[model samples]
Target: MPTGVLYVMSTVVPGLVKIGKTTTGRFDDRMRILERNGYNNVTGLHREFAIEVERYDEKERMLDDIFSKARVPGSELFALDINLAIELLASFEGRQIYPKTSTESKSKVFDDAAKNHQENTDIQCIPEGTYYLDRKRPPLHVEMVVEDGALTIRAGQRVAEHDSDRADDRARELRRATVAADGTVRANVHFSAPSQAAAFIFHLSSSAPNLMALQKVVA
Candidate 1:
């Protein structure tokens, strides 16, 4: 008689979920690698520790099928066999962890200001390519090649998504590019309507130096 087990896990980070099954009880050894790598929030929320899994020759494949259906975008299994492969997949996706509270607090104001400024002007990192607007939407994504001194613009599904939608959807009247005085390849984006151009201009002027420091860390 073959025996097997099933488990459902939720990691320390949000948006991670997984389902897996194993034939043996030694899944912990496989899971330890995750803990070693700082995934301290991993928890097994549900499991069927032992079941007659060997009755079917396709048990491994069956587990894989279950995992494919139940596993979330950022999750994987931990046991050997089907479970190990699943866990490997989750590790590859990379879980998203929250920053510390103090770090969160520090960036909140900058995020707010960015949102406010983005509402009025679309300050974007325009790459070194000519682009035209399509009736569907404006291009919001760019591919940067610093070595080549080129920035290629392309259509994106969302632009300034962190900001609220405006009543008038039209081309932005004011856009400013923030390049470093050191001439490094870096850019910051801000956008506004014609009515808000003056405020956007003033904000960029006052914050350019600080923004440079902020960009340094992000870059």
Candidate 2:
């Protein structure tokens, strides 16, 4: 019958996160303690997402069980993709406690930019060439080619599609991701911008990191 808050924190290490729970009143205090003292000797800890929920203890345990394989023994740390963690946390029925207004609005701006890119196909934000889109956690390396004002997935490894009930459709898209003679997976799907391309490849939202921002130009 315990009600509290569940939170996910990002660590200095990429793709690593800490999932924990605390009473509603102690939420801010807990964050300060973790950020100030650090956890397991790991510093640069920052809150990524949090939610106030009923029976938060049970919710936290459920998440731990779900990600047990990725968890560090005897520790709250898990070697999992931050975005995946965020999605799961957000799905829980509760009021979002972190990423207050300013951050949320920023995310909205990024989404709007993606939408505008889709609607205005003629506006090319990146130059035509080959580039690499690399993500650390749930590690991915995708070779992309931008030509004729279109972005195509030339090759990738460990590509994850958006999770949904449309298994058949997802399978069809995966089928398009063919394996090359060199053993790399290749896809012919075209997108307008890096964000859109990443969203499609990872089944992530518009908030996915834009390759342009990363400056990962290879060609």
Candidate 3:
């Protein structure tokens, strides 16, 4: 029955996180060593979340098993969502060690980060309008709009039809779209930066128009 700290570290690569455990007394020393020399030659390793708990070894093993599919072979790295990892780690019963906040919960960390991100990057910088895919015959359309003081993107496939068909097909498309509380169809995704949005849209459609262009097209 050893008391130790379970820590999650973020690597230079996005979506890659490391989970490990160290004795309470050696926690600070271990972190310093990892940060200074790097782990397995993986530099830029920084602690994201950590907690002191009883039987930290077992907790670490449990987390490894839970995220086994996402784990990198022969490494502690896991290609997992950072926020989800933080939320799951916070759910465990322990004293939050990293972040060194007045409150033990990590929700405040996320809230503050989001607030700072929104403040520093003006979402309104991008004009509110419809942007079509960068193709002769675009298959999808992305509409930018301001709702509740936040910029939102509503994207869906482009369907061509007559007026009667539009009434029926458009309604169906809206029904499938993610609806806000105000009955507005929102894509249900938020981008901290235009580059992030461009990456996401690129994943959806390789030929899709990027946010950098800021070209408003009527389709």
| lDDT score, candidate 2 | 0.64
Better of 2 and 3 by lDDT: 2
lDDT of 2 at 88: 52
Question: Tens-digit lDDT track for model 3 on 159-197?
Answer: 222122213333333334444333344455554433333
TM-scores for every predicted model: 0.23, 0.50, 0.49
At residue 24, candidate 3 shows an lDDT of: 82
Which tens-of-lDDT digit does each residue in 1-219 have in candidate 1? Answer: 654443434444433444444444465654444345533346533321222234323544444442343343444533222222222222111121112234443233333434443443232322222322111233223222211332222222122322212312221222213323222213333222111221222223321212211001112
Query: What is each predicted model's overall lDDT from 0 to 1?
Result: 0.30, 0.64, 0.55
TM-score between candidate 1 and the true structure: 0.23
Order the numbered candidates by lDDT, best leading: 2, 3, 1
lDDT of 2 by residue, 1-219 (tens): 667888889999976889999988999999999999889978889997787888887778767765666888999998866655555565555666787756673344344545544554431434455665566666766666767878777545545543534233433355345544443556466765555556555555544323222223522
RMSD of 1: 17.9
Who wins the lDDT comparison? 2
RMSD to the true structure for each prediction, in A, is 17.9, 13.2, 15.7
What number of clashing residue pairs does each candidate have, in the order they appear?
A: 16, 1, 0
Of 1 and 3, the candidate ranking higher by TM-score:
3
